[model samples]
Target: MQSVADGSQSSEVPNVLGDFALHLSAQRGLSAHTVRAYTSDLEQLFLFAQGQGVESYAEMELSTLRGWLAEMASRQLSRSTVARRGAAARTFFEWAARTGRIEQDPAARLASPRQHKVLPTVLAVNSAATLMDAARDLAVEGGPADLRVWACVELIYATGARVGEIVDLDVRDVDLDQRSVRVLGKGDRERIVPFGVPAAAALRAWLERGRPALATWSTADALFVGQRGQRWGQRQVRDAVHRLSAIAGVDDVAPHDLRHSAATHLLQGGSDLRTVQEVLGHATLATTQRYTHVSAERLRSSYQLAHPRA
Candidate 1:
């Protein structure tokens, strides 16, 4: 971790940040992506502090943290990005205080802006059906790549797993007999998410027909593989979803839209919020509640179309 601060700033800042990053990855089990994000946020904060002539963590104050946030706002950063940065500051300061690196936690009083609750975009029932039909048709073309794409979309829609989790899956993680997949989600939490029979059939076809065509000794036991017979990447999965959606005449949809559609469809079909949360591997019920809003909006639209009163 190189110092983002100026020459006048304390070198200890970078050292402490390096230690914190290590702790997050080794002890707290945070994913590499999360650790990188937190470290980046803290580096920006340190650079801001250097500009303010605050050379050490011990000199940090609530007002200084607030000024940094105000600077972010001035730069027109998104609410989610500012909020995440605030959270990163809070967590870092808390750790510093607990570990006796700092005399007090300046960010203890810091507050993150409330994240706006925007409903995720989901495919309508007809559109989702069309997209899956397109993928099925592609699979019927008998190409290894087409079969893999069909299986990926089927598993995503069937289980609502994140693209990262889907790509991380190994052959041992999928249980065809149980119709479930073992997902390793954020914070390294593991959960078993169930898929429907359609997904099972697609998965079986890919395993029997598609994967063998691509697989090599170097492919190991990954459930999904790329054209080069290595583990599938999230970007490739997302691109495949986008391309398939466009072919189905539903443009601008991503892999996550399939997840959102799965959750919303489940709610519309009478699945409870808690069950959806568990299936989606959401840490909080509040995170899962967003799908309820999507379901309600769809119901209202349907009612408006069918009711006698205008």
Candidate 2:
């Protein structure tokens, strides 16, 4: 058994977990994205154990792991984050057993906290319009930043992509000739989403005038840039959305809401469930079905207003 730094066995120890992560990524057909997340989770756990003066993962008992989770709970990490961490721990221990690094899977009986099925929040059609108009109004000089702001918000609502996918987008990502933007989403999975004339126009405006103005010798291949002349970060894009939503008088509007609104509106306009799911890059049909609830609510409102019933 590995000795703890404090010379006490509290069921927490640190080991070189990177090799296991690499094995999972290469041999198990796990995506790089998942491998990164799992490794990060292990790193966090290792750091936490070290802070407590524990030496290795093999020394960690179920109760020690539970204590770490309880600490995370006290810090209010969301249920989803907690669940992911639990899954990471479980997988790591199981891998350790398979590789003969451990005698048993210490995380075998551990379970993640149940997550709440929170329905996504979406902007009303009028509110979405307000958001677009507000972003357009903020485009001062029609410069790249302004153009980027315009294009980002417009296409987010139009294409419903996660902000990272948008930030990582390259020049070739947008095919104006095809009227679609190619998005590489989580797991490096690629999909092409169609946008209307307005989104295409905004993108063209940015590419022609805005992007050139912001372009530098050191500029990467990214389509969006910050004031620092570098590619846009996820936080920067999210902050842009937050600020624009505030200006649009819809403070709760987020990048994801634009996605939700886009999917919801498509369904409202008679697009099928599977089509929206494909457009949104959802992995499960049930995940795509939540919009049905939103549509039913809208229908109920329409019936109430038009039925002429007392």
Candidate 3:
């Protein structure tokens, strides 16, 4: 409803946005998800700019950027989503300036609201054990399918690897003898994550008894294969996790929750922050620090439940 620009100043907005997207992918090597998210936010900005009568990336002043954010806030958007949009704007303008698409970065001094921090959801230690126990129970009573499910859940929680990384795994990525698994993380970064004996044993059983029945010529390298012998999909892994939860009588959780639980459990077990960061393949130590908070919260909960004094 606000009109900051009265006339069409530039029509190169779409073209510059395309170039920005290419830079994000080819030059920056950001993940597809990250690239898409950034592009989506920019697209919304372009729409807002169109309504404001601003025409080009170079013409977008700090007021234009602030106005765009203010508009989103007026719409009552979540702070995290709004914060992400602010980040996208900063990234776009910086790239535009660096690549000479724009004379200067308009978002240089733009200040966006910080995202509201929410604690990650994690399972308690006993609940995690119950889930694994249920997975094992199913594997014992059932065939290759159950064994594969057991192995998938064990490996996910054990390594704190993202489901995308887990589904992308190759048979060669695992080393049973050394108890370590090579996880290719975001930005194509690779790291070795060690698992406990429980995970190793489950992996061994799946590799020997389960994967053989599912592997085909095309899926020979795939560590976890689907029913028709293609590489396992993330959806399939999620389904397995849900099924395990129902059977285990624990609260339902997704694969990422398992990752959160694993990180928290490692911290509770006395693993240092750096070691947990390496295991999770986080780009920053700050991301890994959240698990320490989860552990502290649990410690407080335990003390409150046990202590008699007010």
lDDT of each: 0.90, 0.81, 0.88
lDDT of 2 by residue, 195-306 (tens): 9988888888888888887766666577887787788788888888888877778757778889999999999889999999989998778988999998887778889999
Model 1, position 11: C-alpha lDDT score: 64
* TM-score for candidate 3, residues paired by index: 0.92
TM-score of each candidate structure, all chains considered together = 0.93, 0.79, 0.92
lDDT of 3 by residue, 1-310 (tens): 1222433434465466678788888887788899889987887787687678876656889998899999889999999888999999999988888878779899999888988778888998999999999999899888889999999999999999999999999999999999999988887889999899999999999999999998999999999999999999999999989988988999999999999999998888888999999999999999898888888887888899999972
- Considering summed lDDT, which 10 consecutive residues are worst modelled in model 1? 1-10
- Per-model tally of clashing residue pairs: 0, 9, 1
Model 3 segments more than 4 A misplaced: 1-15
Rank candidates by lDDT, best first: 1, 3, 2
Residue 135 in model 1: lDDT: 92
lDDT of 2 at 117: 74
**Candidate 1 residue runs with Cα over 4 Å from true position:** 1-11, 303-310
